[model samples]
Target chain A: MNLIKLAWRNIIHDPLTLFLNIILLTLGIGLINFILLLNTQLKDKFEKNLADIHMVVGAKGSPLQMILNSMYHIDAPTGNISIQEAKPFLREKHPLIDKSVPLSMGDSHKGYRIIGTDHTILEFYNAEIHAGELWNNLYDVTIGAEVAKALDLKLGSQFKSSHGFTDDVDLEHDHGTLTVVGVLKPTGSVIDQLILVSTESVWAVHDHDHEAHDHEGHEHGDHDHEEHENGHAHNDNEEHDHAHDHEGHDQHEHDHSHDDHEHDHEHDHSDPNHHHYGEIAPRRKVNDLSREHLLSQTEKDITSVLVRFKSKTNFQALNMPRNINENTDLQAASPAYEINRLYDMMGTGTKALQLLALLIAIVSAISIFVSLLNSLKRRKYELSLLRVMGGKPAKLLSLILLEGLILSLLGFFIGMIVSHLCMSAMGDSLYERYNYPFKAWIAHGKEGLLFTGTILLGLTAALLPAIMAYKTDIHSNLSEG
Target chain B: MLSTKNLSHSYKGTQAFNFPDLLCQPSETLLVIGQSGVGKSTLLHILAGILIPTKGEVLINDTSLYKQKTNALDTFRGQNIGMIFQKPHFVQAVSAVENLFLAQTMANKAKDTKRVHTLLDQLNISNRATAKTYQMSQGEQQRLSIARALVNNPKLILADEPTSALDDSNCNEVIQLLKHQAEAVNAALVIVTHDSRLKDIFPNQLELN
Candidate 1:
């Protein structure tokens, strides 16, 4: 205890020296803390996004980009597949399949990406509605948390689609405004920056010209009544008015068109019982045609599929995904595997930073040694006096060592503080750019052990100077006057 | 009870002193009077075991001081001997009391605060106990050095030119303090000096020519 007191006194006596040491230590620890926190946050984000999905089935492209788009919701999708091609797998009920969510991307609302998917995507994400219920009909929209915040959007808010990736230009369909039906709670995922609508809505906007083309085709043929009954030839002005009413007006139009088609087809038949049968046949044909159109649309294209496994295994179920990519026309990736590989590639820089911290600590120790050694010469007579007055060499040695230990511990404490402040400042930017959450700095477990180890190293570095003090010849040095 | 017989010493291959015989009994102040360069300092160093004699033995209470190991010699010096140099060499960074405490530590004893204060009082410098060594006047530093020397109550007191840097009054005060300390410990006092001012106070004196 006395030795410690002496050490502390020595440091307190020299504020400039102590401050310099603190600065060096703070810089070293600050760099280490920044790197460590960044690495932790990146790994956390990757792992969180990796959960719930087993594999990504996407268009043949960079497997990394496919995983990035499908799992992280960043980057453009390779392209989309028709629902028909996705239906066989969806119907197969394979235990391994779990559930499939179809994602169609290409449009943007403000700067956030627009995801056109079915209600199944919401269910897959277990997304909670913060404002209203899920969209039940085409054109109804739900927005993620960041999308709502950035665009100042809320439930019932209307927004037009932008031309490109930004909200700058007016597009061809800028006249159409999508009403937001719900706002999703923040999930700390890529979903947070997205605007999700029904897949048909996406097809509806892009295929509006197709609707006009169908109208022209119907006018040329005897299917003019069929076109009106199919609900494709509604007045453009009435469609605009119905779009403003978010209360199932579109569904009502479909039902009315079905009833009119049934009555017309039945009248065309001569026999009454034949009329009943003709009405049923038309309904079946219409249903079959719509189903076939949906199936054919999704057949050739798929951006990606996220696969979740039944058991914890490393690349065990990778074969099917790889084969799909190599044999079939779609690409697959394991997010966990790819992310681990990415961490491995990044580990070198982290290791180098750790090495630099170690090196700086060592240099600091040597500096302590040199400082004490130099002080020994100036204190020779004083030391001799202590010896002649009955101070044992061991006690003298301890006093010198105590001084070194004090300096190092002070430096370590200062360094830790510096690291904490720096990380807190950078945390917001990291979340903004990478969707990562920053945790508080706490020296527990391995970090605590490292801190203690550094202090011990500092103490050990004082051993040489202590030995020099112990070897000083008291009788000879004192009587030399 | 300190004695040396046929003691001789050299520094860097040059002879510094050759003392045929010397002795100082308990409670006695034996002044070794000598001219400059007559080996007063060298003899004092040899007697204090600071320098190893090349030709003879230095015995303190029948123990051969030169034959002991370095660490043992240090321990023996700290516990049994007190040294006063021509100039007071206290640790400049520490206070006078701390210097005294250092002396007690060297002897492996608890700091005797009361004794240190009393010794400083006797030397008329007790007020300077908390003063840094560098801040103390030369006379006060010299007196504090003497106090530090006596803090462990050593059995043998060795002083080399202890009054050389002091005025007559301060010299008299230091001589009285050293004499009182030696008598209090029942130890032998050996003072080596070129000045003959202290001649009348010592009944038995060794004159080296």
Candidate 2:
């Protein structure tokens, strides 16, 4: 009965035009929303996992790949550095170091990377064992909440791991079956999708001296597997014997009193000439220690070392990574620097997509204008009749304005729904592929601005048409009709 | 009551029109008869406050219409004057009853569905009240327009050639309907038309040359 009611009638009089306007506007707004939601979540995930890790120490390669591998677990490691090479930073009492967790990767279960680190990794993720207990020994595995849910792993479950990062089941390492000791609670971090095991477990899986490896008779010549395996055995021996063999591989074979064991281990370990720290722990003779064991503990190499500074304000912390990069063979990469570089790379695509979405919105506004203008011309006499029925010129103007607003609002709502629908669809595939969570409904400040812009677009498009309705010559139109 | 004096209008590059003075009391009916292009519609528009005459005043209840601002004039017209076009036009999307509701609402009057139903029932078009305006026949549309004009209970009703498009019998029926509605509301009625038949029906008549 009011101007708005009349405008509603006028719009519904031609539903096709309204539908067309809504579809175009929805597509534009939906695209904008989709891009915004993705970018926000991606940046958030990157920033969250980049928490407090000042530097990544790894074998020389792409720094970004190193950070991506160690911090986010999204890429392959940049080869491994020997324990001796990483000794200073890993030392508990080192001046610049607060804590250091070593990671030994290059294995996967159904494409989810199995990360090998100490108990500190749980603290790093702020994770809790929601069920059962954390891994306590070699071959004892604890899965992330997401990994447990996705792979349907449970307490007391056992699964053999495959060698290297691959989805193929054919490359299964028959060395040992990792027992599921725990399932961590959801931390909303990258830890949710990781399969966590002790670094010793990683070395044990590759260790040849284990009876299981002899039973399998697999050639242990794969250096990546063998070096990492001895590191695992040394870790085991440290746990039982308190040999404190945290630094060198010689005490590993010397403790077993195997000169034959020393022969194979010495082949790789003796290239570096240095004092064997593990041999010093047992007060073993220098003649019993191999030179290779002096450079690396257990003759093993780990993927990377995650370093936390004693204090961020410490000057030594600032100088340490640089010294590691310039003076040592190992490379240092900062998660913050590499992630910012990633954002810079993705920013251009986001901006271009945003522009395209805005252009679609503007074009939809034009369609609204045209549709209203067309309706106005057809309803000219009807409008004149309204004037004759004692409607003010302003009333007629408001009628057209209301119609435009209704169309815009309808289109905006439909656009939001469409965007979320697309997100849900894309989110499912993305989760399946990369384990990235994309929630359907995510409202932000930018969307609020988008709503305001939609209203403005609607009202602005109606301006000329409303003015035309206002200036309509009631006398002429009535006479002609 | 309705009155007009020295009412004149001129279109750009066209001849000027000079209208005779007029006066009518409440419940009075007047017909201004003219040929096409005699500015009969122009006179009706001026009386309805839809057009501003080049010279003169249209006084309703002795208040000069031309003396008011555009907004005030519009409000005054909405509340006091009801107009029926030559053709029975409407907001075609709405129902016949809704058309009456529109008239009441536009005049800043509260909706009275009871009164709307009563008016349509009185006009004998209550059966078609819920039907869209386009669905109604010609005579039904005209009667609905009459119902709309009377819905607001205005002080004056100005209809332009109400019978011009109707047959002989339909024309007589429409005139009787308009007169009865005007008398029922106690309003002055001024109808301008080129139809000669109306002159026989209305004793208060003015002829435009």
Candidate 3:
């Protein structure tokens, strides 16, 4: 009976065309919203994590890869640079350098990167301890907030690190198990996705991998002398001595954990007390590795160093990256510059998708217009009858316009819901791969504009048809029948 | 009562029409019979306030129909005059009851479902009250239009070619119902048709050449 009711009824009566119009509009709006979410969230995450690190110095490779690996932790590192090589930037008070934090990355536990770093990294990211304390002893690890929640790691929980940033069991280091000493509060930055430990912990784990053979040789010599004094020939010990003389030395090659090597060597003999120690080899405290002791041998290398400049002056800003990249064997990259380049590359694709979505919306608007015009043409007599029965021109005009508004509003709502669901589905996979905390349900500010734009499109498409309804010559139209 | 004096309308290139003076009191039925091109429908439309005549004015219940502003005139038409077209027209989306309700709403009357029901019952369409107008038998559609026209209890009722497609018996039944409904509301009735068979039926007649 009311104008709106009548308009709604008319739209329902033509279900096939109604479906076409609404579906087109929904696809247009949904695609646009989806593209908006991806662009905004990715930019937010990339920029937020790029905290004042003016340069990254690493082994010579792609500068972008160095930035991504060091600053964002999403790509493979560009090899390692010797501690002695990075020593200048790592100094306590350099004129041009405000601070430099070394990152020793090459390991992970459950797909979360274990980044061996100092306490200053916590300051750089503005992160705070949520529980327990910072890692101070060898094999002690501090976890990110997301890492703790995702892996269900509590203080004192222990896990062995894999050799690279993946959870492949084959690559799990025979290095000693690392104990959780602390959990960090989330800073909405890359720190929330990293596991941090003292840089010496990384060197110590690698040292154990290479030195297990040397310790085996020295221990074998002492045991041989003891056998000679006791006048006893242990066949297993003889076989071990024979195997150690060969070049392969496959037993200790993969059994690189020092404790595991000692356990294996002791297991060949018949000392009950030593056998008990063998059983607890993985739990043995190999805790002597400290930052001072490890850096005393400056040949030990780190993955990269994140340097913040004292001032972003024109001279240093223009010269620092070039000096490091050209003069030294290390690759130096500006995190901000590389990230901006990345955003520009991605922005092109996002703009294209936005344009395509806009085109679809325009086509959808036309569909609405054509369908409404057709409905008006078919229902001219009905309109005239309204005019004859005390309906005004404005009433008829609004009836047609109401049909368009109602149709587009339905399309807008359904489109938004569909886009959100699609985003949530994609967000889970993206988070797993990149560790970016993408909140899929957060509607951005442009969506308010999008809402208004969609309504205007609907109304604009309905305008001409509504005016036609308003200007209908009722007598001529009625008498045509 | 309804009356028209010196009423005429012209198209852009056609000769102008000159209409005779006419009068009909409340509860009285007047039939205007003519051929297809005689502009009988035009005269009815002018009287219904659907057309502005080139000359002269139509007066209904002593109020000149065209004297009010366009919207006010429309509201006045809704409140006081009812016109049925040659073929029944309806907002095809709604049921018979809803269409009658729409008619009363358009006329600026508070929705009177009881009046609609009573009219549908009198027209023998109460059983089809919830059916869409287009889905009904043609006879039922015509009766629905009658219900719509009388829904507001208007002071004047105009029917244009009300029974052109009907048989003699059906035509007689339709005219009688129109006369009865008009008399029940004490409204003036004007019937315009190219159907000459209706010339002898009404007591008052106006013939358009």
Candidate 4:
């Protein structure tokens, strides 16, 4: 009834050509949508990874690599430093330094990267233990959501340490089992793939191995003594000494047995006597393998310390770690700076893709122009007839303009659906690799702008065709025919 | 109701027409006869306010048509004039009633479905009102165009070789239809043609050189 309706009817009259034009326009819009979605998802992942800690302190290497390792857990660490060496800076009670969580990573239990950290890491990272309580002692471990799910581990289940960071090991440790006490809720972070335990647990494993070596040395000495006595026809004292050696070896074998005979003996003896026992009475504690001996055992060290600031402070507190690194032999990195640098390096590719989308949109606009201009020639007689029947030039021009607008809007709608489906397909891989929660229907500010811009471009493309329609010499055209 | 005085026009700097004086009173049919390329269509275009004369003026109801703005002149033409082309040039995608409705919008008036149906009935094209222009026969399309033109109740009706393709019987029927419709609205009817068969249908004739 109106010019716009008439224009739409005319476009639909030739469905094949209109469909082709719609496809072209849809491709242009779809490309733009895909780029926008990718850019948004990547930026969101980066920001989420940077949410907790303000700075990272470690042994010096590439700053970007340090960020990728500590924040995202995707790259190799910058080696470890002695915690004693880091103690002096930690004691400097700066007003800006809110809290610090030391990180020691090297060991893994069943392919999950084990992170030795303090209890403050949970609060600092806003992590909630979904099912069980947090680990309070050595050898008790808490695993992240994906870790639990992948290994089918539950609270109270004990799993042995595998050889490497990945689950492709041919070697497994004997009796080096860790108890899972908690499983963390899914935060869509690097923590979701990590296994967390207290720093004391890391030291206990090494200490336990050292004690086993000492027991083996004692057994060897007893065997040598018994062998020396067996070679001689002995006096009564010598006979008694050989008997003592045999008893001692027997006791050693009994103490080192894997059965619960010793535990049953202890439990029966301690039940009635516990009330009379004093707090200071010497009782065997877990992993109390003498701190002096434990420190002298091996040279495993910490990887980094993630420092959270109290508020929006300056980079002054950041310089403390840098000074320590410069004056001594350690490394410090500002995650914010490294992330910005990384974005700058990757932004060029994003910019290139955006430019390509823009160029394609322009070409699409020109295609629309050509299509409408061509239609003008074919519809000349119809245009002249309208002119004689009191159709104004403005109405004729608006009709063509409306046709272009309809094409662009339809293309935009189809493009959105296409982009959403594409994102949904990539969502699993994206979350796995980068820990990004990419929802299909997430809206970006630039998306609205892009659609509006396409509509405007379409209107602009129609301008020339509208002018041609307006300037149609109805009298000359009619008279000639 | 319509007159042209000392009308002359040129195309590409060559004089194509020179008409001293022409007039058409209300309720009268005037036929313009000429050979091929003798500017009969050009004269009709000028009289319909579609083309401007190089030297002379066209007045409709004592007002100069050339002095009005382009849009205003279009509106005035839509409300006061009707035209039928040699071949019916209906909007190919739309039905006949829709074409008539589009004419109402062009005249900046609200839709008058009653007027459209009445015009279709009078033209005997009521049965084909819902048919698309491409779907209709040539005669049906011609009649639809005539209905579209008269839907706005204009004061002048201009026909440019409207019956050239019709048989003798159909030609007379078309001529009589235009005459009857023009007289019904008290409109001045002007027909431009090279066909000599319509010479006896109109009492007043202008032979173009």
TM-score of each: 0.70, 0.84, 0.87, 0.75
**Looking at candidate 4, what is the lDDT of residue A59?**
75
State fnat for each of the candidate structures: 0.59, 0.77, 0.75, 0.72
Clashing pairs in 2: A248-A297, A249-A298, A269-A292, A270-A292
Off by over 4 Å in 3: A167-171, A203-294
Lowest-sum lDDT 10-residue window in model 4 chain A: A274-283
Model 1: runs farther than 4 Å from truth? Answer: A44-49, A52-54, A58-304, A309-331, A475-481, B5-20, B33-46, B49-76, B120-127, B167-173, B181-187, B195-204, B207-209
TM-score (C-alpha) between model 2 and the true structure: 0.84
Error of 1 at A279 (Å): 34
> Could you report the DockQ of all the candidates, in the order they appear?
0.36, 0.66, 0.76, 0.58
| Ranking of models by DockQ | 3, 2, 4, 1
* Higher-TM-score candidate of 2 and 4: 2
Residue-wise C-alpha lDDT for candidate 1, range B89-128, written one tens digit per residue: 8766556787777677666666577987888888788788
Give the best candidate by DockQ.
3
Better of 1 and 4 by lDDT: 4
lDDT of 2: 0.77
TM-score of chain A of 2: 0.80
By lDDT, the best candidate is 3
Task: TM-score for candidate 4, please give it.
Answer: 0.75
